[model samples]
Target: MNRTLVRLLQAPSIILLLLWMIIPLSMTIYFSTIRYNLLYPERSGFIGLDNYRFFWTDPSFFPALTNTLVLVGSVLLITVVLGLAISILIDRPFKGRGIARVMLISPFFIMPTVSALVWKNMLMDPNNGLFAAFANALGMQPIEWLQDMPLFSIIIMVSWQWTPFAILIFMTSLQSQDKEQQEAATLDGAGFWSQFYNLTLPHLARPISIVILIQMIFHLAVFAEIFVTTSGGPGVQSTNLTYLIYIQSQQAFDVGVASAGGVFAIILANIVAIFLIRAVGKTLTV
Candidate 1:
């Protein structure tokens, strides 16, 4: 009777979760198969795989895919490496460490739109931004970040926002590390680099994998920073798969093609997620 009651109480949440996920996914799949356009709703009909074919064959498709891969990869590398280093540095006690940690983690809470806008106007602006002022002070011409280096700028903004999350995870993981192992290594004259390589790194392996898995999932769908900063402009140089879908649905008003793109994105995310989960499983088990 107790077990039955527990399940009965959980049933509502489980059903709600299923509906929350299934409804939009069903709608997207349904629309992806039909010839639907907001401009010509009357001409909508069963088109089958035509939308998928068109989206696949689109001129911007490959570039968008490549950009998506590059953005995700670059951001992951930056955040993980920097976060690891920062976390290790701050793991030791220091003056003002509490205040420093609070400041570091604060960026992760900022909304993506706000972060992009701040980066675009306050830092990356060619004429009056902080970077430009610093460049002028150093007797160098300020580079147009959003215009000339759109993808890189987006990567920087995203990395800044996400590095804090990685830091938090790594720091928490470090707290649970075996101090006896470190003491033994220290007594054996294990230098800083040696200890890090042999002890700290192995302990951190799981946390690093966890960070990568979570960040990979989020970064794969990164759109707001790009949309706010570059709008995927300068001739699709910064366009990723997610932004490409937005262009299709919002700018082109092709619901079917956008839905097809959405399906592709979902497939890609699932593939990456599966691979990461398997890799993490191997690491954890070993």
Candidate 2:
């Protein structure tokens, strides 16, 4: 009776959630099948899979897809490695540990737009930015970041923002670790590297998988940073799948194409999610 009542109370929220997802998805699918254009709204008609074909064949499509993969992969690698290092460093008691942890995790709380802007104007400006000043002080030329290395700059900015998230997760996982096992390893003449390789790494497998799965989903839709810093330029160098869809919708006013791109993105995200979930599930079980 209690379980039944609890489920009854949850039904409204479940229904609302379904409707919330289903409505927009239904609309997008409908739009994807039609020749919908914001500028030529009167000429709208059913176009079948033409939008998908065009979007798939688009000149920018492959580059955007490649960029998306590179960004997500690079950011994940950097965050996981850096987060693990930072978490291990601060896992044990240290001077001002609380203050240091708070400072390190603070970046995760900053708004993406603000973070992008700060990186753009303050650090990667290439003219009067901090990096440029440091380069000049060292008698080295300041390279144009956004212009010369647009995608790398985006990767760096995003990695900075997300590393803190990984750190937080790893730190939490570390707290639940078995201290006695570590003590036993130490008494058995196990060195730091041996203990870390055998014990610490094994203990962190689940958290690392969790972080990768969550970050991968968000990384697929990285937009604001690209929009703010590079506008997917110079010449689509940093344009990912999300920004490519934005260009189709907002810049070209092609609603059908944009909706088709959205559907493609959704499919890609679902595929990644499935693979990651299964892999992580297996790791957790083992």
Candidate 3:
């Protein structure tokens, strides 16, 4: 009787969660199967896989796909590596460590749109931005970051914002580490690199996997940074899959193609998630 009552209590939330996810997914699948352009509703009809074919054939599709992969990969690499280094450096006791940690982690709290705008106008602006000012002081040319390297610029912004998340996770994990093992290593004359490789790295493996898994999921859908900073431009050079779908839906007014792109993105996300989950599981088992 108690178990039955508990299940009854849980049913509403479970059903609501299902409906929340299922409704939008069902609508997207239905839209992908038909020609339902808002601009041409009169021409709406069942089109089967025609929408998918159109989306796949779009000239920007491959470039958008490549950019998405590159952005996710680069951001993951940067965040995990830099986050680990920063966490380790700050893990030791120091003067003003609390203040340093707050400053380092503060970037993650900023909204992505605001972060992008700051990077665009305050940091990356060629003629009058900080980079240009630094270059002028150094007697060097200030390269146009967004115009010359839009995708890389986006990667930098995302890395700056997300590295703090990785730092938080790693620092927390490091706190739980066995200090006895470190003292033993030190007594045995193990140098910093040796101790890090033998003790710290192994201790951090699970946290590293977790950080990668979570970051990859969010990185795959990075749209606001690109939208706010470069607008996926210099001619689609910085456009990822999410931004590509936006271009189809908003710019071209092609609901069917955008829906098809959305479906494709869902599939890609699922595939990546499965692989990451398996990797994380292996780390946990080890």
Q: Provide the TM-score for each candidate, comma-separated.
A: 0.94, 0.94, 0.95
Poorly placed runs, candidate 3 (over 4 Å): 275-286
lDDT of 3 by residue, 60-116 (tens): 989999999999999999999999999999998899999999999999999999999
Question: Would you list the clashing residue pairs of candidate 2?
Answer: none
Ranking by TM-score: 3, 1, 2
Off by over 4 Å in 1: 1-3, 275-286
Among these predicted structures, which one has the highest lDDT?
A: 2
Cα lDDT computed for each candidate against the true fold: 0.94, 0.96, 0.94
Error of 2 at 160 (Å): 0.5
After TM-score superposition, the amount by which residue 268's alpha carbon in candidate 1 deviates from its true location, in angstroms, is: 1.0
lDDT of 2 at 218: 96
Runs in model 2 deviating more than 4 A are 1-8, 275-286
